[model samples]
Target chain A: MVAAVKRATQTLLLAVTGAVLLRMAAGDSYLRYVNSWMRWPLIACGAFLVALALLDVFREQGSQDDEHDAHVPRAAWLLFAPSLVFFLIAPPALGAHFAERAQSAVVPVDTSTEVDLPPLPEGDPVPVVLDEVLLRAAYDDGATLADRRLELTGFVSRDKAGTWFVTQFGMNCCAADATVMRVAASGVDAPPDDQWVRVVARHVSGTGDGGREEPEVVVEQLELIEAPKNQYR
Target chain B: MSESTRQDSPPSTSGSTARRAVGLPVQAYVVFVAMAALVMSQQWLVPRLDSPALATWSTIFVAIVVQSIPFLVGGVLLAGVIATLLSERALRRLVPASPTLGVPVAGLAGVALPGCECASVPVASSLMRRGVAPSVALTFLLAAPAVNPVVLVSTAVAFPDRPEIVLARFLASLLTAVAVGWLWLRFAGRVPILHRRSTHDHDESTAQAFLGSVRHDFIHAAGFVVLGAMIAAAINTFVPRSIIDGVAGNVVLAVAAMALFAFVVALCSEADAFVAASLSAFSDTAKLVFMVVGPAMDVKLASMESGQFGGAFALRFVPLVIGVAVLSAVGMGWWLL
Candidate 1:
């Protein structure tokens, strides 16, 4: 009976976590945690986990390895918590809370070719990531961003002084490595914190344009939209 | 904690009578009730999760767990394959006779096995049982999880712009493994590590045993990983970032702080690079210390060593390796990184 319970717990833990990742990968759900590149591995491992669980379930009943049951093994029960968090809570993507806590890695002002920054595209409202907006503002040559109406999408983040910034994070591996980037915006009604918005704005060359401090984005338009399927850039 | 006492206690007459009265095994009934209540309480918990601290904790916990599942599966699969394909006698022959040569050889051989510390535990125990030298077996145990290809690739991905950090991690971790193995060899007389399990249980066929071991390893490792992630999340969320930010500017202080952080948090080697990357305030070298020290020694790993190998091995070995690891990480950070 102890053997049966052990087998059952292992099966449930793997099978459930695997299925959750699979479900996330098949659609937009996985984007909440990891990037799209991880989808195939997530799906493959999910299937593998389910397969392993099934094999464990159907192994020859009497073929149990004759090792004695260990301690009460309450520890094994903790394995179920991850699956519970996934299915029950399935918490929203990284929000303002994490953004405030995780300091943005300062992008150096070198503007060297090594940063591999791409050329800004030509459009009335050129769509770009918030990281790109901050990068070009802080590091790009003045003319590249001069007079261009760059657009970016990010959730609202507010500083202590009641000023709002459009911000997003770029994940190196998972949400844990997500680095926050923010471009302060004004002249638009404040969206409540954590509400995703697409900002159509351009660099304003004024007193604050030292290219070292908070790079300002003149908010020409602010349209509230549902958060993107994948939150990280 | 005494497993022998918990082993299959045959259902005596009274045991069945009580079980019949409850219409279920008491153990099963208790678990079932607890799970039901826990799941039902989600309604209450979900409302509170709106708080930033709670929500942040939940997200970090979720991320770490999701990130590790693949590597955990991979670890078990690799261990399972090794178990299914290779017999004890066959593997023992691969090592040299002299423990001196075998120590470094086994340490380097770990690069071939891609897994974490938990997977290596069972593999090392089997090696000891097969009459392998304890130094060689212990070296393989430490090295297998740390220097594996999967972990290195993840480390590279975590620090994409700096290939040298990856190189430094490999060299430092390899040096630590070899150094610790030699230390074990010198101190073998003072400290003896008896293999935990003693018996012949190969009666089951290879396929049965292979799947059984896979299930066994996955359940065993995943439980610990989940526990470790939860503890790390709480530390990550509540512990002021100021603790880390305070010392980021000082090289010596930063290294010490990150090393202690790695030990207390006990993150998995595969996913630790990501966590280290998040601490961008710390220099790349400090991050190097965190990575190098983590797989070789951590609070959870120490306790696990005590559980499997015994307190004598764990108590003595942990400090020796920690000291060696800190020195090697600093050395590599100065020279390579």
Candidate 2:
């Protein structure tokens, strides 16, 4: 009876976890947690798990494996936590909430070595990553962004001083290792916290001053926008 | 723990009577209560997550778990293959007879397994059981998760411009593994490494055994991964960077801090490089310490090592590895990075 119950629980755990992975991958919801490269791998993992569960179900009854199954620790059942979190809370992508708590300013870079940055593209409002704008402001030796009007999109985050900024997380692997990149906004009232927005702004000259302060931008145009499908850049 | 002990015991007369009376085993009752609570808690719990901090924490927590699953699964499957296909006779043919030579060879052999440290514990334990030298097996355990190609590639990717960081990590991790092996050999006479065979070694078919091993390894390792992820997520969420940045100026404190941080995070080696890369305030040498110390010895690895190699062995081994790993990283970082 113990063996039978163990088998059933094992099968149930595998199936439920697989289903959660599949559900996450079936849509863009997975982008909330991991990079796009992870989607296919997650799908494959989900399928493999379901297949394993099916195999367990069809395996011969009272098999020799069942006698040895008693050794599996009860702690193994804690594997359900991820599935439980996914199905229940379904936390959204990291946004202003994380950016505010993580760091109020843009991620710092080495300033001793001057960076020879390339010029921005030929457009009145050249589309640029919000973090790249901050980087160019902080590190670029040529002052490439001094006169340029750049279009950036990010959620609104405010520091303790009530200075609001447009911010996005630059993820290396996943949200777990995400670093913040934010550009301070000027000449506009702050939007509601966590509100995603697009802005056509000019980099305020001398604000970044070689990474000492966050690069500030003068907002010429601002528009409320929905958060992108993949929030991390 | 109590439940596990109960499961191991034979069905007593009272247990049988209890099963008849309840119409289900005690295990079933426990599982039922847990599942019912989990399902019932959803509605009550979901709405209370109104705080953005809590939401952010949950997202990062799930993200770590989600990002790790594929690699963990891959590791478990490969471990399953190794368990069934590899034998003691085959292993004996491969490893050198001389313990001195075998230790370094075993360290080099770690490059073959591309999984995290979680996957290496079972494989290393099995290697010892298959008649390999304890020193060699321990070396492989320390090295496999650190120097594997997957981990190196991820390191290279994390520090795209700093090719030297990858080289430093490789050298430091390899040096740590080999150094520990030599130390273990020297101290083996005094130390007791209790080797317990797996509880059930059934004469089952190869395919069946492979599947069973896969199931067991996956369930066991994934559970530990969850535990590690929860701790890591909590640290990431609550621990402000100002506290970490304060020590960046002092080299000794910086290296020690990074080593302690790595030990607690228990991140998969493949993903740790990204984290180290993100900690831009630290010196290159300090970051290298984080990378080297993490894969060789961490919180989760210590627990898993204790579970596999016995609590006595882990109690001694954990500190020894951590010390050697820190020294190796500092040495290599000084030389390379």
How many residue pairs clash per model? 0, 0
Give the Cα error of residue B282 in candidate 1, in Å: 3.8
Residue B33 lDDT in candidate 1? 65
lDDT values for all models: 0.72, 0.78
Each candidate's DockQ score against the native complex?
A: 0.36, 0.43
For each candidate, report what fraction of the true interface contacts it reproduces.
Answer: 0.35, 0.53
Per-residue alpha-carbon lDDT of candidate 2 for residues A49-71, written as tens digits (9 for 90 to 100): 88888897776432322333454
lDDT of 1 by residue, A96-176 (tens): 777776656444453444444466887788987765566666653434578888888889988768888788877765665
Per-residue CA lDDT of model 2 for B1-337, tens digit only, reads: 3233345545563354344444433554576577668778888878875678778878988997888778777876776766777876786789998878999999999998777677777677667766788898899989998999999999998787888888899999999999999999988646776554443344556777688777766765676677777887888788876786789889899999999889876777888887887676788899999999999988767766665556788889999999999998999988986
Question: Clashing residue pairs, candidate 1?
Answer: none
Quote each prediction's TM-score. Answer: 0.83, 0.88
TM-score of model number 1: 0.83
Assess the local accuracy of residue A178 in candidate 1 as a C-alpha lDDT between 0 and 100.
Answer: 67
Which residue pairs does candidate 2 place in steric collision? none
Worst 10 residues of 2 chain A by lDDT: A60-69
